[model samples]
Target: MVYHVLNGDALVSGFKATGLSGEIIVARECLIEGDLKGETLPEFLENRARFVEDEFNEARVHYYNNVVPEFEKLLNAEPGSEFNLWFGYDLFCRANMWFVLSLLSHLEGDKEVNVVYPSFRDKHDIWLEFGRATSEQLQEAFDNRINFAGRDFRLAEDLWTAYKQTDLGRLHDLSIFHSPCFPYLPEVCQAHIDRFPYKGKKGRPERVIEDILKKNGRDFKTVFREFSAREGIYGFGDDQVRKIYDKVMKERNP
Candidate 1:
């Protein structure tokens, strides 16, 4: 039994097209950029569920009842079963990977877990790359999955635990420790830290958006499109971007 887990639903089809046999699970929730104060699974889920519903105005009952249970199945995989994680190198995927790796770290399970990342590309959005990949390419990627050693696990635990904390400084400090577990981690962690508002004023990304709008006189939609094109590495979707735009508008009008 090989369980292939991916970052989101975007690449599920590509994995399935590989004709791999076993269950496929999507992380469903975004742990990369949100409030993570809960100490337990239930508390964490509830916290994220409420945040998503309030921020995105979407319910999480289906996620809690359905998608979460699927993820939990990885915790109980058979002795010989392999748990393959397919993720990208962004903070978004890194956060979820950290959570999953952390969860597996505590469990005394016999299942073999491997990390399969987008090794083919050094700077492209791996999720989008997977979405556009052919079936043969997906299978090749699966065949080339990398197995983690002791140092990787130690680094993973460090990163995962640090990511769940309220102190972004811990993550910023971790940038100095270069490890093979996450080659892009140092830079990505810095990007995450940069996301916080400057002295509780405008966020760096939001300020950049406002500056673009001011100089070009473009509408919000155009500004957002331009931002995505230039700054997609921040892993922010239009909805999150829109909130910042709204904040800027309120600040300007208020």
Candidate 2:
């Protein structure tokens, strides 16, 4: 049986409209933005559930109900199954995709894994393409999925470890060995590193938000559009940028 593991729910409708034959699994947790304080699978999931509850005010029960099962499937699927990974070329998608790979790495089997990219017309609009893909384009991508080799899974496993640990030095070292498995590993690494508070408790996103507000005058639409256009690397939607913008403004005014 074939399984489609999507990065988030936004792409689910588009995927289904393509008439693809597979069980669709949505990654509901924002793994990149939370503290992963567990090593074992069960432990890791519980930790994430707690993080989601405290960070987003979403109940832990919701996490267990919505997020845990899909991940468990990814972790405990039978050997020799086929999986098509549907993720974008952004840090948000990379984090989810890498975590999925890390789980698959623990399973020993002839698991056939493939990555399906968006049919993007412009290089700069990659992050936007997946969310806006047509059924025909989605089908085209699925028809031309890139199969992952054994080494690719190994690399993904290593990167996931370093990513959760936030080991900048190790990530820089690993970034040198580029692979098709990770389309933009080095670039994503740089973007990830840049998110940390580089100056006065303001990360790149926070700082950029500050700059946007100053130039565009407190217009939410203007800021969101500028941020999305300027920083496709993060692949943040309105909700994320809104959160960051609020934090920046709060701290600035306070």
Candidate 3:
């Protein structure tokens, strides 16, 4: 899929081929600029190369884990339908590549606002799912999906808020609920809190149970008792509860 960009209402070359070509050009430019220097140029190029290498690693992961899986699922279901499937698939690949480029552009510290052109023709999928969502339910879904895939929390949070006005409460609730499997989920909530972007600073939970109770509006003691009473549930003794309590308190205090 060819991804185009609109600059001042004029359509430009898409990122899949053009944008990558641009990156290579920039790298060459950097090398030329570095050549003018005596000692610092090598260090500068080394740092730039490291940054590019890191971005490439991240892009590969995002492609394999997020982009490819979605395309594979669609391909498996459809088999040999060639009308829009291939086009859409190619576009999605470009979009994912564009997303990586977007991050790289930021790291490169370019003054011009470089818009990352997605390979996909339609921007709906790019924004609706790949970008951040505004609705509470969709935001939660996106958060959970990111956590399950073990993506960068900051990136997930940025994507969550880019396209919509999200309620911080909804994000907090979702993060806490999904924290066990998604250990880094707490970082997104923390980032939100650090910005003071919303009202009502309900105290964060110290432990998993406390977090669940606070987020879900449940009584932790009652829930624990019920679970303990259930057969084969309380494999650990009361010491486990004490340990959990201690850990929760420590986190809260710390």
Candidate 4:
């Protein structure tokens, strides 16, 4: 059997439109992209779900329930089975992709793993972005998927551990050993590091938002929409953007 694993439910509809016959698992958890720490995947997910429940309450119950069962299939892959990963170029998608790669390295089976990412031309193209692509474009990406090499898996394993620890330095050091395996790793890692509050001057991305709000006097929603369209690398959703805005406002006004 073949499986097309996507980052989230956003792309599931588009993927289904392709009429592909296989299991489509939408990874609901953002794993490394969020503040989750655990020695094992289950522990990590449990912590993340709990973290979400602290804020969202029961709204995430259905999602939390699906995380484990959907993940188990990848954890225990059978021989002759293929797992195709479809993720984007941003920190959110790349971090999740690394998690899957890290897990696959430990699986004791002859499973085939492939990855489909935004091509060079599609890097900034809205059409090829996750949940934005048409069925035909998704099929094109699936048709031209790349096989994960040994180095790619090793890089992912190491990066996954570093990311979980929030060790940006380790990621920076790893960038020295550049390889085609993760051409987008350094940039994404850098984006993740920059998410932290800067010591001097305004924090990078939040600073951008602050400038827009201060200068243009736009509402938070407009600032978020414009900022996302401009930067596009961090892939911050509305909630994340709002969180940053709150932090920036607190620091500035207080």
What's the distance in Å from true for residue 216, model 3?
Answer: 42
Q: Could you give candidate 3's per-residue lDDT for residues 1-254 as a string of tens digits?
A: 11122211111122232222221111111110111122342343345445434634544344345333432332233222211111011212222322333233233221222222223224323222122222343223322321112233343334334312335666566555442322334553454343342256433222344655455544446535532333111222244444455565566669
Whichever of 1 and 4 has more lDDT, that candidate is 4
- Pick the winner on TM-score between candidates 3 and 4: 4
How far off is residue 84 in model 4, in Å?
Answer: 0.5
| Candidates sorted by TM-score, best first | 2, 4, 1, 3
TM-score pick, better of 2 and 4: 2
Q: What are the per-residue Cα lDDT tens digits for candidate 4 across 54-166?
A: 65574556656777677787876677788899887777777778887877788786878888875534445532355567777778878878888778778788888888888
User: Against the hidden reference, what TM-scores do the models get?
Assistant: 0.87, 0.94, 0.19, 0.89
Flag regions of model 3 displaced more than 4 Å. Answer: 1-163, 179-181, 197-254
Model 3, residue 171: C-alpha shift (Å): 0.7
Give each model's clash number. Answer: 0, 0, 4, 0
**Clash pairs of candidate 1?**
none
Stretches > 4 Å off in candidate 4: 59-63, 120-123, 126-128
Q: Candidate 4 vs. truth: CA RMSD? A: 2.3
Q: Give, for candidate 2, the lowest lDDT window spanning 10 residues.
A: 120-129
Q: For candidate 2, what is the lDDT?
A: 0.83
TM-score, cand. 3 vs. native: 0.19
Tens-digit per-residue lDDT, 103-222, candidate 1: 776657565778876666546554333547777777777777877666777778787777788468787777687666576677778777777776777557877888887886658888
- Model 3: how far residue 66 lies from native, Å: 17
